[model samples]
Target chain A: MKLQRELQIVNRLGLHARACAKLVKTANQFESDIVLRQNEHQADAKSIMGLMMLAATQGTRLTVITSGADAEDAMTQVQHLINNRFEEDE
Target chain B: MLSLSGTGIGRGIAIGRAIVLDQGHNDIPCYRISATALSGEIERFNHAVDAVRADLKRVQRNLPTDAPPETSAFIDVHLLMLDDPVISQQPVQTIQEQQQNAEWALKSHADTLIDFFEDIADPYLRSKKNDVAQVVGRIMGELAHSPGKQPSDLATLGSSLAEQIIVARDLTPADTIMLRGRNMAAFVTSLGGPISHTAILARSLGLPAIVGLHDVIDTIHNNDLLIVDAATGTVLVAPDEPLLAQFRELQQQHLRHQQRLTLLKSEKAVTQDGEAITLLANIELPEDIEGLRSAGAAGVGLYRTEFLFMNRPKPPSEDEQYQAYCHVLRRVEGPVTIRTLDLGADKQVDGGRPDRETTATSALGLRAIRLCLSEPSLFKPQLRAILRAAVHGDAQIMIPMLSSLRELEQSLALVGEVCAELEREAVAFNPKVPLGGMIEVPAAAVSADLFARKLDFLSIGTNDLIQYTLAIDRVDDSVNYLYDPLHPSVLRLIRTVIRAGHEADIPVSMCGEMAGDPAFTRLLLGLGLRHFSMEPSQLLEIRQQVRQSTLAGLSGQVTDILNCVETGSLYDLVDQLNQTDSD
Candidate 1:
């Protein structure tokens, strides 16, 4: 199932590289397979290298997908992560 | 002579030779399996791995115990990379397939990997390219037949061309260490910042370094003589006689001034009229304690606890926090005022949520005391550790972002709870440790009299107060022009806080960015503030400023300035004082 959510880029200098990799890493922790697509570019949520390639700017919109037994919960938790810019600002 | 310009991160000068490092090839073949050569290739790869591991251990053993733990952890990662079968096995397989030497195969594979990272647009991600390059460089060196010897060309120019080294790009800390024994005068890189490891190391070693000097490599030719003025961030090429003579004089003057500062470090920080003032040091790291002792700081006024939590993956354990606090207390003979964790939405811990609710206008939101109250689990351990460490010396606990009396009451209750727990556990601790609050918010400053009555002491944090009073984000470069510490409103707030604290007969001190600045030293002193906590670097300079003025004159002039509607330059005020001193 695909989940769409709006998250503000709260960290200084926007949602650049390292923060995106962190988001992807968190998403991969669940049993569910995850994918994050931003501005029409999709990447495997398990690879730090792949998520870094997205170059998600601060305040940019993103779409996330999760598939597995706990996909619903994973999507709900991951939504909080994306909306919080992976919590890098805090 | 070749010259390059860059941002000056550290202040100092050096003259040495240039040693240019080539970006070695990156692609290593995955499999090297000629049936005849397979056995030999495998043997060679194993030996290379063992050699890299030994080299890492040697570096780790030589590192100072007091050095940042990150330095040792970096070496550990390298060791793990060497042991990774995926990395080691692929190169041997490549060598067998291509029928090439193991060294050549590894270099090719590493080059390919580096090029892939170089194509990325993000600068932070791009910075990782250097880390990758370092791993490959070490592996390739290990596989090479002549492991320690420099290439023939570099060997020829070794000690003879000792001048300034201008790199085409940023150099890693490993690269800086390689040039240790050489007479390398200065470093000019195409890119970096004041906070980069290269800059920090250069400052620590007292090397003249300039970063972000674009096109420096192409502009300067080999064997060009250059003069690097680290203070002003200037590089002079082929200078005339007069210019060289001027620099020589300036250099001598700087050295003499430094010596004079050293002599004053032990003297009392008293005004001309014999009024004494307390001078303390504000530090971020444990290593900075040495600087405080050297600068003759009476005590540490503000020990920023945020740094302990900032870079780590999670909050430091209670034992870890206790050890660090105890170490500082034992080292410094004077009072150590430790501010409990001031983290809010702006600073996120590992696995923590980003403070999305905080806005440009939300200076008071989810920060300091507010964050601590909401996150008691995170705040309690630190409080317990600070309270436990107080038994070692004069340790005082300061709570950040206290806007109301109720917040103080609740915070005090938590402290009492921790004290009760310690008593039950039979832990030895100080029962009479003083408690204080930071007056950084305008609301806190406005009601300082009420706050002073409740707390034992008050430290004015001018940085946040100025930011909130003027409604400007100091970090935002676009709006930084408005981040003034000398604004009329800011001065008034400082005055109000000082008056409130003094009226209550409680000790008051200023321990923020404004305290470190020389320009504001007199203004703060004139406002009846006798205690200052600032960076170790500024102690002597501020001490000198303190000794030149009488309290009466400072107070009178400050009163006149406050009454005037027209604003005047802060520099003009300092200059007027200087003129009077000379007359």
Candidate 2:
């Protein structure tokens, strides 16, 4: 199964190192292969270097693609993390 | 002698030799590897990565339970980088395809990642390159088999570096955490401002640190004798013998002074005449609570809430403010006086409202109670939060810079309005929480008796009161010398406020720099300032002074000091007052 959705980075510091680490940790938790695409740049969601390379600042929208048996759960969890501003205060 | 200066973290002095941490990025050997040697080089690369992983994990496992979650999260980022295919597999591909040495291949791949981060537009995201460099640096150190390049090595060389100052380009959170449990004398970093991780860690640990000393790592070397005076942010290298002797003497005196003050921590802040004085802490950050606890303060007298509202794009929500207030309330044992939003003036809140920007530029402009009164959307949430958080402990609201009875009435009405709103929503709040005012404005100080009648308590903010009474901008170096706290008008205003609080039967506290000054402790006591609030560090020192004074004998000298015509004579009288009071 495969699913796709777009989410915005809303945290104050954007997808900085820690936030990227959080995203990668969440992505690696499932069997799904997750990839995030921001504009022309696409990166494996499980790669902190890839996410950092995208340089997604606050309000940058990225298309997230999850494909596997647990695609639904992965999508749900990834969406929740981004929307929660990576659990950062402000 | 050569000296470098930067912002100091705490009031500490250390004399030691220096040990510089080279981030190990300067030199890299680029060379071709023979086919057979290429495979061995790749294995060597894998081994280094694994070693760094174990080292980082060891540091993580041994972290103090009290370390902030961010510290672990920081190490997690590097750990994840170690596992990520971009970092782990790319260098192997480089070694296999290019037949390059492991160090050269890894450095090339790491440089690509760091260069990508550098091109990012956002400054914050751009700085994330440091994390990548730190992780790569660790692996590089492992590959080189250098002993002291890795921070984990600090633990292994603990005894040798124990009496030496650590000079680093910058310290990662993990480095700081590892250094915390060590007996390193001080830290001098080539990078970082006052709010950086190194600065915060040094302050919390009471370790002397000087940061933002650019190129300091290159300037100092291992075994270079050094003197660190954090009070002046000075790091002196190889001072002359006579100057070294002088500093050694000063260091001894400082140690003796701190030891003497520490002995007074458990003693009550009461005069020799048997009058008990309340010595509370003026807290700006949550970290200050530790200092307050160690100093044995009565409670938090002025909890500045402006810090919550500043440095953010939007004002904190009502829930956030309530949680923050409750955090302090639960930690404190006695009354915690939460000062309402004192933003504007010099403290410009970034995203509060673009329209209010112009008004916030001047000291006398729309600020403090004025700004809060004009913007109910900004003010109501704080009012509601304080009222609700009051349920958790003895919380009191103290409004700042209340210059008139009309503003006081408007503030009170807003509080009432907030209470009604909370009631409508059926929220649990302390409706009877004490409401106080800061008597900083000369007008408010003059008419403090009237305001005292309407308020629960009053606190004299002598810093602002002295600044305004003397019409001097304390920040301006030219006129600050004239900014005298002992000016006749300033003394009269303080006296008036104290007398008014006495007559109105309300507690009057001084929550300014003056309250903590031992020179003025007796003077204020003579003028009847029974409640004092100051920085947590000053509490014990002030307590020592308070324990030696008899208020009965001070009154006569205080009157003379107050009536003295010349500033010179006034200072002389105060000196005489302190001289006679010494047991």
Candidate 3:
């Protein structure tokens, strides 16, 4: 059930506190181990502080890796959230 | 020995011991822990973390429904940070592997985290370092104040904060709400302005506050005697005996002035020419009834029902709302004007109701009466509750933000439907409860005659009326100077609403900040406004102003003020109206 994909951050403010909070909340909803990797920097998807530490700005591409029974579903939601720009009007 | 100054909220003074909170990280004790005592130290650290987590959860759970969305969002980030393994686990490792004390270990990890954030190129992300520091500071505060000390001393530390003046870099809305019930003497903060939540809360609670006192925490230590002169926006720390005695006398005089005002509580609010004024109190919580009684107010003028709907997972059921409304209804002696859910703009509630979420910006969006009408599940329970609660006492329903006759017609229809449903269920309710409208929206004020013919009474909420008319957000500190209540347009609207009430033979009451302000007391009386509802703390002061005025002489001055073409002279004219010897 392992899945991996490259996703682009489309939101203008990138991963700010509110954005990170939204991402972490969505990632915590599934049983998958979600992680994001960007240029040798990796962050656990469930950790807001870790997501913030990546300093991923708009247009930055990150590789998402999910592994668990619900890995595919988690990956789909994570992709949808980023594609929708975290529901923010940027 | 030291002095600091800031903007003061009120003209009150307080003398109390300092309780410095969230001080900078230069003073943390870093001592070597014995090998055998490591487990005890680790246990103490764990307990402090758990205590802080519990405290944060409690604050989140009890958040006022009207708190801005950012307040909850900020707390959520801090809560998530607390759960992150980097924060929760790394400090434990530092304590165990490096044999460092708990405070030292946490500070080391926090510094590392802060450095990582500081290196981020984005300015917004760099500010996240402050969040890390604040989270760590909370834990540090808990450690310094709680369990590691002797058990008997723990009780004293916990109970003594009520008497001390809180000094901090700044206070969040959550912090202010948590401190609201405590009998704290005053607040001195390093940041904030007149419109900040801290200042607003202090004014509502009738306490003195000094905000914008930069780096106040560094100079004031715990248990240091200090004098907070809010009149001059000064904090005198560790003063000598002579200075202390001088301030003590001043504090006594300030208190005696307040005591003197209380003597007017039982007196009627009437002009010298035999015109009587109805004075009422605006309240949010049922406990405010205590102040209403103490001030000898006529009754609850505007009882805000939003507190019942905020900070919870879901809206209250019909029975629950009924019980809450009845609790306030049975306690009050006169008519209670309970405004329906004015939940929009900055006062949105996060009670898990999805319908309240709108795409438009809050100010001009679907809120108040519009939101209620669109969502019957949200509106009907409140209507049914207010009707049922009216059996206990004189309760009236007031609708807020009604703009046009179409909305009024729809609102009346919905009320009719609720009445039919309640009657079908054989609910013991009073259907004769008067329905009033808050003339806060500009359109409603302009069409006051039409609305007055339909509604039973009209209450002018000047806060929103002024904001809507001037196109200025009162909370925005940059533009607040332009929020003049004496503006010609604002006065004309007030006059229009009052005249409509007089023509329709109904009472027009004002329940805004303008009504409570003593300077505007005579001006409002001159404009034919006889009913005034304000904060209970201001009731006696306004009553004294009412008793000293002669209504027979105000009409000519008011006519001059209304016809005033120049803006600069409007204030002078109002000041002259307040002068008893001028006429």
Best by TM-score: 3
B1-583 in candidate 2: lDDT tens per residue? Answer: 7898876766788889887664554466455665766777788889989999999999999999999989999999999999888778999999899987677888898989899888888898899899899999998878766432222234355544677888877775546645645678898887765545576557545678887777654566555689989889999987789878888898888889888889888988888878999999988777779889999999999998876765568889999999999999999999999999887765677645546665636768788899889988999999999999999999999999999899999999999999998999999999999999999999999999999999999999987898889887643434534767889899989999999999999999999878876778888988889999987877887898899988886777777877888867888887777777586
lDDT of 3 by residue, B339-411 (tens): 9998766666665255546545456777888888888889989999999999999999999999998888888
Q: How much is the lDDT of residue B505 in candidate 2? A: 99
Model 2: lDDT of residue B272? 89
Q: Candidate 1 chain A, which ten residues in sequence have the lowest lDDT sum?
A: A1-10
CAPRI tier for the interface of model 1:
incorrect
Q: Which stretches of candidate 2 lie over 4 Å from their true place?
A: A1-90, B2-249, B358-360
lDDT of 2 at B298: 96
Span of ten consecutive residues with least summed lDDT in model 3 chain A: A13-22
What value of lDDT does candidate 3 attain over all alpha carbons? 0.83
* Docking quality (DockQ) for each candidate: 0.06, 0.55, 0.51
lDDT of 3 by residue, A1-90 (tens): 999999999999998898898899999999999999999999999999899999999999999999999999999999999999999898
Please give, for every candidate in the order listed, the TM-score of chain B alone compared with the true chain B. Answer: 0.64, 0.65, 0.75
